[model samples]
Target chain A: MIELKDVYFSYPSGAVLEGIDLTVKKGEYVGIMGHNGSGKTTLARLITGLLLPGKGYVRVNKIFTTDSERLLDIRRSTGMVFQDPDAQAIGETVEEDMVFGLENLGLPVPEIDTRIEKYLDLLGIRELRHRNIRTLSGGQKQLVNLAAVMVMEPECIILDEPVSMVDARCRKMILQHIARLNHEGTAIVHITHDPEELIRCHRLIVLSRCRVTNQGTPHEVFGQLLDEKKMDVPAPYAISRKLGLSPVLTIKALLEELCRSRSGN
Target chain B: MSIEIRQLTHIYDASTPWETIALDRIDLTISKGTVFGLVGGIGSGKSTLASLMAGLGTPAHGSITIDGEPPDPGRNVGILFQQPEDFFFEKTLFEDMASGLLHLGLTEEEVHKRIHSTLDLLGLDHQILDRSPFHLNRGTLRLAAFATVLTMRPGYLILDEPTASLDPKSRKRLVEVIKRISGDIAIIYISHRLQEVVAVSEYLAVLEQGKVAFTGTVPGYLDWATGQDAWEYLPVLNQVMYGLQRLGFDVDLNVACLEDAVEQIRLSLERT
Candidate 1:
């Protein structure tokens, strides 16, 4: 669980995020979106205890974000995967890397090995266990990063553009995984600019100029974006138009709708 | 002032296990002052082709000539690579744009004039001149990236995934700028979306498995590309209409924009 009350954060170049209020309950998956420099990442840091709020209070699992004594416990409850895969993955080998976080958590040795395999299989990275970190591509590196944190079995994960640099296939896989994790009762806060991924999120939030511009399910937030016509709808816009369907987001859904309608017996 | 390529081949990580033959005996010509669009899924070498044109990378074999000279990364070509954050490092917009021109041997006053004009052309206010490059949002970063490259004034202006992360308003503004700027330089605009390419480009190329699969007019390429499922990023209305028609329903493939589709549906309803 997370809670923020009347928070304010600023950098030297004026104020990045000011007078913010937010809350993320346990087992809730939220996606945060913005164009850029929208204070989305700043908010992420505030939640993860990376930055102390200049004003107001942030609570993770009922513990204050600024409480030094509760910092380790609060941090243990959440794990993060950044946009750049290279920045994480400190270990040389995948298996060793996965175990590094476990070691820091100070779990027992045999249990650590079990967790390594368990999460590696959970994230589908078992085959890459023995590979060197540098040999993996951008997507593979990200998967390993996921596996590493997952072994610790944190209650929630905060992913900042986890699939930004990845190929389309991997992007789909990661999005599906995020959905699955959310279904399994793990909270997720995904920050990204890609709409294809945004459509997959359960609840979406938009940050503009460091304030919560909008918050709702993907349908609500992006529906407003479409209404503004500031952004173009996905491909097959014409197909939806012909069918007179209310602008479905993905192609598969549109196809299904068309199939059902054309069979109008 | 025409562009020509003959048997262009590019290899990445040559001789290593990851040696990828990016471009393979590709030959093509793009007339100057035209929008040439490029498309492909990831690792298809579309970016590689742009890099070659922008002079960021050398062709392993064959030749590329722009205005009768080879494409040189260090000179003559202005390239905005895929990741906007990669090429940016300076503190201020002025410094970022001036970094490239300092080597071109321009006078200080000349650099200032060029920088201000380019910023104005991009519709960025002069106040943004003093802001940190990193402080700007993704859309601003993208425009700043373009401004930085355009300040160099190369014969060829290239942008890889130029508008990928941009919002709608900025995207429209940037597209307008590109259209206005195209008359003076060859624009090698690389994007995955066939629709955007169709809207802005006179010429088009689709990269598949490291080669040019389709190269012709934008409409011609889209006609072929729309059939490939468009990697699922293709517009919603187009696919819906096409899928319905595939199942023996009536649908028009000519509807490029969403409003036209909406109007078509409402009109069809009245007729029915």
Candidate 2:
């Protein structure tokens, strides 16, 4: 679980986030969206304890991010996948990189091996187990990064634009895996710019100009955002609205709706 | 007026234990004033092909010619790699743009003119030149990196996932910039985002395991995709149209933009 109250963060250059209040309960999937330089990444780092807030506080699992003594506990409870995959590499090979975090956690060797195998297989990267990290493509590196984080089996996973570099197949696979993990009671805080990716989120938070401007269910937030022309939305949702029908998330649902309407059902 | 690639193959760490064939016997042609999309799964050799086209490295086999001559990397072909901002090491964006032009033996006046004109062409303001590239936001940094390349006036451009981490507004802006300048230069737009590829490209090549699985005009590829049942490769609007067609609805599958798709769907429903 994560909570932030009246959180205000600033960089040496200037202020980034202001008067933020948010919480993610256990197993809750929250999506954070904003334009570039809108303090989205800054907020993610604050929650992960990578950076301390300048004015207020960020708490994960009831442990304050400012609590340096319990930073390890905070890290164990939460894992973060950064936007850039190249910056997160710590091992030469895929398997080794995955094992690095588990080894640091001091898990038994058998446990570490089991977790590495489980996640690599889950992420569909088993064939890349021994491939050099440098040789992998940007999307492959991103999968490796997710596998490495998931191996830790943290209570919550914070993904920053996890699918941006991946192909459509891999993107769907990663989102499905993340959703499965959330269903299994792991918290998810997905940060992305793509509105389509947030369709499945339980709650959505919109940030802009250093403040929280919107927060609600995906339908509620997307409805208001679309009306305001403030953000780009998924094609299905946009078309449904244009056709005087309730907005839907996926293309399959939109087709069903269209069929039912044509039949007057 | 065009780039010709034939039997191009590139192998990493050749003849060694770590040898991996990055590309294999790929052939393509990119005419000036066209946006050619190169899409594939991760490690499917999209970047490898881009590098080969940019003359970053020699291919293990086959040939590449830009306007019937070997590609001259900065002068004839400019590549904006993923995370291109990382390549900026100058004190300011202006100096960064100037340095590349300076290396080409251009006079200071010419360098300044080129930078300003490129920025104007990209719809970026001159005020950004005074700021450090490091301090600029991701969107601005990307455009600045692009300006650095466009200032050289390359006949061909290679953009690798230019909109990967960009927000929607910035992504739209960059796509517009690509469309605006695509008239004067051939662009190889490499990305995992199929929607963007569909939006900007006239022709597309889909790679699978270092081989070209499909290549044709945008509409031709869309028609091909509908038959493949690989809905992942198609944009959401196309996917909806494909799904409707499966349910026996008469809709236009070749439509790309949402407005056209919506209109097609409306007409289809009214017909029934």
lDDT of 1: 0.74
lDDT values for all models:
0.74, 0.90
Cα-based lDDT at residue B75, candidate 2: 87
Native contacts recovered, each model: 0.29, 0.78
lDDT tens digits, residues B150-215, model 1?
888887877777776465667778899999999988888887544566678898876766787888
lDDT of 2 by residue, A31-94 (tens): 9999999999988899999999877788998899999999999999999998989879899988
Candidate 1's TM-score = 0.82
Candidate 2's error at B110, in angstroms?
A: 1.7
Backbone clashes, each candidate: 23, 0
- Model 1: number of clashes? 23
Evaluate residue A91 in candidate 2 and report its C-alpha lDDT on the 0 to 100 scale. 95
Q: Determine the TM-score of chain B of model 1.
A: 0.90
